[model samples]
Target: MLTNVPGYPRIGSGRELKKANEAYWAGTASLEKLQLTARQLRRQNWEAMQQAGIDLIPSNDFSYYDQVLDMCLMTGTIPARFKPLLERLASPQSLELYFAMARGYQKNGLDITAMEMTKWFDTNYHYLVPEFDTTQQYRLLSHKCVEEFREAKSLGIHTKPVIIGPLTFLLLGKIKDHSLHLHSLLEQLLPVYLQLLTALQEAGATWIQIDEPYLAMDLNPAIHQLYINTYNRIHQAIPGLQLLIATYFDALGDNLATALQLPVQALHIDLVRAPQQLTTVLQQLPAGMQLSLGVVDGRNIWKNDYQLSLALINEAVQAIGQDRVWISSACSLLHTPYDLDLEQDEQVLTREIKHWMAFAKQKLHEIADLAQIATGNNTSLAANMAAMQAKQHSPLIHKPAVKARVAALDESHATRKSPFHVRQESQEVAFQLPLFPTTTIGSFPQTAEIRQLRAQLKKGTISSEEYHQRIKAAIAETVKWQESLHLDVLVHGEFERNDMVEYFGEQLEGFVFTQNGWVQSYGSRCVKPPIIYGDVQRTHPMTVAWSSYAQSLTKKPMKGMLTGPVTILQWSFVRNDQPRADTTFQIALAIRDEVSDLEKAGIRVIQVDEPAVREGLPLRRANWDAYLQWAVQAFRIAVCSVLDDTQIHTHMCYAEFNDIIDSIAAMDADVITIETSRSQMELLEAFARFKYPNEIGPGVYDIHSPRVPTVEEMSSLLQKASTLLPARNIWVNPDCGLKTRNWPETEQSLRNMVAAAVQSRSAVLVN
Candidate 1:
């Protein structure tokens, strides 16, 4: 029996990667030390799996940043812009290319910026996007897969190496020059992959897992043929290396027929996501080809019912025989928390409930155990089955009030007090601002002192009164600064909040915080998500105090910031017992109360940020409408309680809003701000094509980097935006919140922003 998982968590259990990476970036740690720590982590991860009896362990899953970026570095497909910096660093071809692509270099005649990065597949994780041009060349920069496989072998473990397939890699990349199609780059990139596969075979790797998740997306007919030809070519070139082409996040769409025809050893499908794909997949299987059934959930923290998963696995075994069937997770465990074992000191009920659950480690064990059962290893199977049986019958799984409420849901709960056009007119009359008004996405810089004070308060080193006073002072200072800059709208700076989601989670019911729970969102960015336990409700207003106080200090409109219901649920550890839609609605009702409270407190403008809403869209288009229906309803329920005269705004970051343009318009926020500076405001083309009616603040500058945009640059971006969007419907702002930047850079960026807006207004009138 083969026992393996697609991928495991790379961010260490206690966020060791986050701390180590940040220290290295801040120049507090040496490269050699960081490398050693990463080595140790790899060893520790491997040993943990080996000890738990997992075979076919995956290597090269560890990445300093993202796996896709690492694949680009390994394949020698570095964009030409980073070449000068790579030459100057005198660094190894791999390390120099990788770091340069992740963080740009501006020294030694190298003034190139990093490629654009965005969220990866509905998770908080981000990946560096590969930039392709007509003249782009491909070669092998480093043997990362072979080296990692050898590293594991040196530690007395044989491993299967993994790589993102060429199709998905190209699909994820952008063609900067626009003349070149991604499909054309495939032939150039294929030889490098073949070379890597041959090296892995020489290094004693018998099985390789190539991820081609884009195959599950709606593909062009030409691309579908390309998948067949690409795999057939590779299989013919290297017949000895067994390849397992894996697809997840959705079922194989029109590509299923082509996927089955590919010359590969086995097929892995995500049963947890698309359970209906099982029968069709079994019927389509060719003789002698193995089936790696992905039955356990990988993206969520839910306790799996082994009995249910066992039934599915048993059916696969019945169809394909025990030897031909294996077990694994539906997708990578990189999206989940590390070990639930570390969360022992949490609430007793939650902790006890967690024992029924499985993290990466436990999931691996489950896969092994299920494989053993399939092979008639019955000694431990009975106990495991009984444990799962007990949990399914537990009282915690069902609550009458929650069930009744969800069943009786009405359409009225999902609608606003007034229609959008009426609300727009009323809001315009009440606020009365000029065309192309200036504002900021909520949050100013969260300084070291603020972070320290928050930590001190958590540790009981400071009183609540002291913390509140310090936060209030910070808010006042921020308002004064915005007034001095002559900005049109102001924000409270979100000084008291640790994160956009965690802050609201702290104030709501059915949620619990983790002391050491950390998951990597990007390179050095980590978030500790709150776990939702039971019925969700709001006991009190979350942001009213800080927002009302900030309004008291500012003559300008102070936008009250709240994380929207969909984002709060998406980013948190949600309950497994109830349907997610029910939990989302409960959260929506709770946020509705807060919105009403904010309006009652004289807060005229409120911003409900739904950054994760796009990420929560279902992977398959067939299932999209149902998910979007509930998600949009949840947002409307939360914000619709406020009066029409109250200007309700929503902010979304790092999303491709083209497909969801109708939904974005349906959201019906009076004003919406989105992250567009990274793409040169190209995302606004969607709004232009749709002729979107609402006000938009297409960001004038990118906030993810430390580079303070020049006034001329910001002015140029605003002028481009004005061409697509009506000047009256446009607003000027940064791409995102300033929590990651230092105060000095934040101040300089805002100054440039205000100056650019003033310049744009004058230029528009003259034209």
Candidate 2:
């Protein structure tokens, strides 16, 4: 009746902490080989959740770049522009002032920038937001969850420690003085989380898991009385600290009697995302309270249906009986993928779909066999009920012409045969581009010899005519280096893709793939996704032969990138037996037949992208209009079958498009390339208070900040995005992909972003 695990998978199953934090940010590794690969990936993720017996094993969820920026450098919550790199990186801490506040400090000449990242609630896993102000204070800087709980109690492993809750760290921070009273910063951050949970209950932690995922969001009534005065002032300052709070992805609806008036002993809940709030948190169980039950699916790879987690662990062990019921993980397997048995023998799914599948070390053995079949020890529920009846009669999961083209789509297959001012006067008379046009957001710097010729053409030792004659000579040397950075809408440089949704989930049909499943997606990035599992279709023209061979080596308007069917169904590992808007309208009619075969292969500027469509919204604005009306009709059924002089674009990353700027201008997408340089153009104040009529490339340089942005800092963020939009609906790029940057900072940041779109088209012809 025990087994918890609100976190694990600190990126190692061959990411080795993304190659030791990019070889210690390229000084070729050290700081004792990146703290010996973060102490051997936190001792192989605490020896694989203590050999999967896991009784609440958590310990600071290891991070080099975000456990909410390690609780904003352990509650000192710096952000006054990283307090002068945390007072020249010393007694305000260092690891280069925590990677110059998570990447943005121009070596020694001290240039700063980086604090603001989003999506960690609606997880595609990015965090670093915490800015706080109204004279922000709070103290206990970094005991790093009590030195990773005495480094897992000197490896004898008595773990638990997890931390983040001073009301979800001031409700995932960034108050920046909106007269900053998140209840006076959670009562000035609850005595620095009661001196960091009384130093993890004097370093032998009985149970500390604090993480209050904002009690599964959508709270009010003063954030449910600031989670009842921050857990009744840490249960009256450590009244024998047990804590465990944790809610996850969703539901705790009407905040379940303010989460059973929190005098926290244990709560957990997310029975694979709101299993009808487990009959109201086991009928409000509080006497000697303890429930846990998250019942496994920590953001999907799918598999543990040990008869639906032993019927919700035998109804929370018959209403909190078996020693107050436990069985965890519906939240942090850090959004899954560390080991589907390290995806051995190059798994492409079918060995009966790899026994239905399960990563994060088989979800810590499905939360220790749903706590040994709710304590009866029913032998791992007979091979997870024969891989859940062989994945429900799998004839490799149905198609019938991809369910009759997502049941013959409607809304005229998602509109667009010309609008946004008639596709901006037919894309300005078909590409006679100039005023402020510069492009990118399709990859460019995936080097290391293009990931070793896409790993020697997937190890057939590089043949398919020597990997397309070395990917058509790296797409004719990146279309002559984006025409020597004069860049006016050009981009073949996907460099024979690997992941922008696993290169269109490897040519689409019911997708499989996994040679070490990857995952991370932020700092030192990771990806590898592609799991979708059955009934998405278009098995050809997946990027019209390298975008019609980079549009016959470019005459400028080349683009054609593609990842969008709601970012290939919000970055894959999907198929939970249908209706994620019917697998995003069968991956938007297979990216609308690869955007009408990339406009019949003459490819006139495609793009697509959908950077995880605001990481699939719905963290409850009463479920964001049924998930933004089928994610703006699956990005208008994947670029509405082209030709309003075919332009189409779409990019979006750090998505806070001010509460979905009318579902991102109803995703009509005639050019949207967002992510305003880490909020410098401040996400162009939501396309300038929604006067947003398409075309807004607003990224003037922050390809995830390695810091080479300066042609007067990309012409002062394209002159603060032309005083917030319509200097002819602006377009200058770079806030997203330069595939995790490096070709001398992607050629001096697109030559300081095409000299800041030619100095914002000479300040728009000097006003």
Candidate 3:
């Protein structure tokens, strides 16, 4: 049996790629210099995987931005808006155009909006969603995949080139014209894949791994047939080339039968998510076809149980001979950190938790070891099993106080003091605001000056008093701006914070901050997830001082922004010693303390963001109920401490609320704002159908892009939202925070947003 991984993290160990890309964007580094840095990182990643004894090392997975964006670049799927940037380019092929597509560009009086980005199938990672039109044409714009394959081949690694499957590419994309279908362009799309495959075959590649993760979702028969036809055509076109159709993130379910019918050489299924499918798969898989068994956990930081994984691999091998079974990771290592050894401080990570944990590097080694054990080479298996057993029984993991507190929890703790109607009346009386209140989703820009000041403070170059003065000044300035814009709700701009979760993690006990443990959240967006160890609790107020200070500056209500418990737990490198729910509840209690403290300090409108809650949903359907139950309870326990008049609010972004709208309502927040600007409020149909009984700020403009929305555009979205639900239930805000944006775009966007709110007031007041 051979060990294989579909992909690995493209961001370098110390975030070399992030630094390089930033320097290039800043005009400090040349394109050649940035390309050199990327080349070095990619070489290091391939070599690391190679050294781990991986037989089917993957190429073309590494991208400066996102893989989907790379595909867009390769297939010449450039939209018409980017034509100006391309025309002005000095070189025939400039990465500036690529970067423009990923992040919108504004230079020399030209402006272009970025394509929409959303959650990559229930993970924290985000991808650029493709946009297609009938007039969209495809060409071999770049030979990147073929070039990478040759590069790896020169380095003595005949790697399997990985590409996003055509079916998945079309499935994730939306049609530019509402009257057209994205799948209609599939005929044109298949040629690009076919040409790429022929090129890879010529580049000395024996096999190719086509990632089609969408197959795991609940696909309709038409979509399933599309998958079959797409693969069948490719298989027919490239008869000599071996193709492995890989699926991950969940079970194949009904798609299993369809997948088995494909004429590919092999099919990879995530045995880690749906282990029960192994028996059916082995029995039903046609003879002579290969089965790549994904047994290692690629999503979590926890170490694999070598014995259990080996047994599963053995079962597949027993059914379909060892020659036909390939052991691999359940999904890409894109979701995990690079290495555990980088976490040098044992006092923080601890030996106990460290023993139970595994990063990407360690995970690769686990896959190799599992392959060894499955192949009847148990040289080090017994020792690893003994160590695992000993760590499971470690006393350090079992915190008696934490367990007792969790067990003592009852329904009262997770419920609001009053119903939604009562809270709504009290909130209206407290604020006396007009319909369609205009507000931001917390945080203004985290400018370079702010980032530099923060770095100085961290390095002890600035005093605590000096930092506090700067933060207060920033908040005062933000309040002045909001007042100038005539916004109903204000925020402090979060100048005192570096990241939403890391700021709170620094104040709370049992959480350790990292200096360079950055993991890629999306394109050029790397987040250093705080390490949560031991039982969590609050020793002092986290956001009370900032929120209270901001409120003092404005007559308009300043929303107390805090990251929710579920979000904190989801965004952090959590402790694997106990159940995630236990860790989550502990985080909730800590947030509860902060919420109560904020309320006492005269902070009325609290906005706790749980953007990661939906992303944290388990991949499997059977496992979702248990996770959501605890996750919802955790969110409630954090904000339920306040009285009805306090007007508790929560914000969620990059989430699909349709499946969990009931749980969202269950949180009992007086107001809930979600990301809808990218989808143009398409996400709210579920809320409309369910009659979601709370105030909602379905975002009127997409903040993630640089192109500012016009007043008419924002007004049009709010008008559409008004048609869905009671107009009073609607609020106006940007899709997400403005931290990543510049001052110019943010100012224009908010001005337009306020105009849209004013225009929508009549609709809101009609009933």
lDDT of 3 by residue, 1-767 (tens): 88899899889988889889988987999989999998898899999999999999999999998999888888888877777777788852468888888878877778777777878887778888888865557887878899999888888888999999888887777778786764668888889889999999987899899998887877788887887888788878888989998999788888889999988898989977788888988889998899998888887777888888888888888788999988899999888888888888765566666777788999899999988888778987987887789767766555677677878888888888889998889888999998889899898999988998898987889998998898889889989989999999888898878899998998887776545567899877899888786788788998888888888887889899999998898888787667888899999988988999999999999998999888888756667899889999999988888898998888998767888888888887888899887777889888998899999999888776667888988899999998998877788899888888889879988998998899888656675
Q: Lowest lDDT 10-mer window, candidate 1?
A: 346-355
Which tens-of-lDDT digit does each residue in 547-573 have in candidate 2?
787778767778778777877777788
Q: Model 1, residue 60: what's the lDDT?
A: 88
What is the alpha-carbon RMSD of candidate 2 to the true structure?
22.2
* Candidate number achieving the greatest TM-score relative to the actual structure: 1
Model 3 scores a TM of 0.92
RMSD of each: 2.1, 22.2, 2.9
| Model 1 per-residue lDDT at 312 | 91
TM-score for every candidate vs. truth? Answer: 0.96, 0.36, 0.92
Alpha-carbon lDDT of model 3: 0.85
Better of 1 and 2 by lDDT: 1
The TM-score of candidate 1 is 0.96
Best by lDDT: 3
Clashing pairs in model 2, backbone N/Cα/C closer than 3 A? none
Q: List residue ranges in candidate 1 displaced over 4 A.
A: 91-96, 106-111, 347-349, 378-409, 417-422
